[model samples]
Target: MKTFCNQEHQDQAVEAIKSLVAIPSVCNEDANDGTPFGADIQHALEHSLELCKQLGLETYIDPEGYYGYADYGEGEEMVGVIGHVDVVPAGDLRLWNSGPFEPVVKDGKLYGRGSQDDKGPTIAALYALKAVIDSGAVFNRKIRFIFATDEETLWRGMAQYTKKERIPELGFVPDSEFPLVFGEKGLLQLHINGTGSNTLNLSCGDAFNVVPGGAVYEGSRASELKSALDELKFEAKIDGQKVEVSGKSVHASLADQGINAIVRLAMGLLKIGEDHPMLHFLAEAVGLDGYGKNIFNGVLEDDVSGKMTVNAGMLNIDTNSSQLSVDIRIPVKISKDDVVAQITTVAKEYGLTYEEFDYVASSYVSLDAEPSITLLNVYQDLTGDTKNKPITSGGATLARTMPNFVAFGMVFPGESKTEHQANEFMVIKDMAKAMEIYAHAIYRLCCNQK
Candidate 1:
């Protein structure tokens, strides 16, 4: 409960975050010997590891660019703190007040693409370890800080790292909100395929994990589609043969908060032709609803986690073939197999082929567990806020890859949730407080109490 973090530590953490945000480490398909996730991500990884080395910690970077880690202390047992350096692509840079890669401080907030999603928290964690080491605390266990590059994509970095490196017995990922995250819903990405017609050419969305904000369509029946869109009060533009629709973008895990432009455009197209396979499939299977009720039976919910969410995040259609990329978050109690089976059946009924990939199972840690209890106590003691209890999240984190690992705090309670959104920013004071909390948590778990 003692305060180990000072203004100096806070300043160091802020500078580190700024340095990292200056690098646009968005994942790319370009692969090479040392840059599997492209050169930018590789640079970010090396920069972070070098910072660790500068802090007098032993550092290691995987040769294949899967992951990297920094270690402090010497002991038989180890504790881990995992975070990702790669960020999602900044969509439509015009939406941001400042450059997405350029870190800007205004009104005591750090504004950038990865500021809140990861870079800020990652830097805070490194400084937390530094504080513990500076305190001259004796440790019975080693503390390993892991940096991953592909968390925004398929998480191939963490997957490969686990196969080649050591897995900590107990750890926490500083990727989610505090008090603590005891449970996370399973993550599933599905691709639905169907034959395309000569009616429309369409494309929308950037990633499967984010709702589509705008879609462009070029085809016939422009007047009919325009009428339908106007009736719904949705944003749209019709010019000759091309039509564009705009909707709000949000994390696919929180699909309910977003109005998917892909679905809205499909519905408008449906009013033009009911028999259009791609449009009908989207309207009937995906629909405007976020619950996948009409498509995959009913909404899946549980007492432990919550209701399931489905988002048609990406869509493409042309004269040859069409594909719909979907992201679904299943509650802890639901089985992925069951959901897949139902979706496959529905897709087949619509003459669309369905295939699911990138499956991450739900993770849960009992409230009675020592690690959970310790983390919660540290958060409560640091902030003097004990009313907020541990909760479940729809977003999956690296915590699901290893046993006894759960997502701790980087995001604070009542803060704006802006991960994977335009103009993302982190409160400066919250970042400092998170550093303090992480410092105490790391010290308590790594130091020898006996």
Candidate 2:
């Protein structure tokens, strides 16, 4: 845990993160650009690769713009530092004190979308590596910094990288909380399609991984809906024939912490005696209970990774069709098929067709394993917190993209979690601390070996 990160390095890291945050790199599936993710994301990948090259690493950008990586040192064993450039859409721009892509520093916090979720930590890792490299640290194994393109959505970009590149023997993903993540729950995103109401047409949410902060209803029932919402003491705005409900936003994996506006709107609609398959599904089957206990009779729990969580992140209803986008985090020991079967059964009762969208299987690394033990030791040594040991998470990371990989650092314990929410930020001091932790961990994993 010797210090190699200094004030200059911290300043540089912050600048780099701000540069990335300035890019609105939300994934666009329909851009005419040949890039798999879209033009903005491709720009992010190119920018990150140039940063790596400037740091004296051999950089490679995927010809198809699916992924990029920078390599240093050389050996039979390659150690990976996995990260993603793409971020979730910045929903409801009006909610932000500043533009989601306009990076700003105030009161020692960097504010922007992707500031905490990934771009900040990813750049911090790069600077941490830069610190180690600048110190002339000996490399016993090659280190690869993988820049993935499609992490906020499906991991198709990482899939492409894995399909073509050499897999790392051991690595760590800097996309989770410290001291280290020993286990990650399986991430399941799917849609339930069903019959729609002839009179109701509504849409809410933007991503399967984000809890919708606002839901709008634009129809003749706006007045009735507003009255019902007022009766229920729900926060909402009504203008003419449109009503919008407001709720707290957080990552879908931690849906329990968020107040889903879509769910609130559904309750309001149901209270007004308005009926639709998606509305009933939301109000009855998946109310505010994040664990979805009613849907499965509380069968989705485990001691290892705790309870299973569910988030109805999106709701869409039209004259002819309706669909509910759901994000579920299954405990490590739970079978995804079992979870799917239970949800499918419930969907059948509502005459909704369940369709799977994307799934990332759970990943676990024993606390005693090589990189896990090494990383935890580095963190405890640097921070002197033995009480905070390795823990499991509901959030998925690039750790699942490789064998012997686990998520470590970037978010410290007892900090406000603000990754996917509006006004997302990363504390400046935390970024410096994380860079030091990553530097020490990377050195232990990749350097000073025979």
TM-scores vs. true structure, each candidate: 0.96, 0.98
Clashing pairs in 2: none
Which 10-residue span in candidate 2 carries the lowest summed lDDT?
A: 291-300
Q: What lDDT does each candidate get?
A: 0.87, 0.91
In model 1, which runs have C-alpha deviations exceeding 4 angstroms?
31-34, 219-224, 238-242
TM-score of 2: 0.98
Error of 2 at 392 (Å): 0.6
Report the number of clashing residue pairs per model: 0, 0
Which residue window of length 10 is worst by lDDT in model 1?
Answer: 28-37
Tens-digit per-residue lDDT, 1-450, candidate 1: 467788888898898999999999988876554578898999999999999999999999998888999998878888999999999889877679999999999999999989988988989989988888888888788989999999988999998999999999899999999989989999999899999867667778899999887787776677678888899788998999778888888889889888889989988877766466767777877787788898767788999999999999888887898999999999999988899999888888888888776788899999899689888888898789988889999988999888888899888888888888888999998898899999999988999445
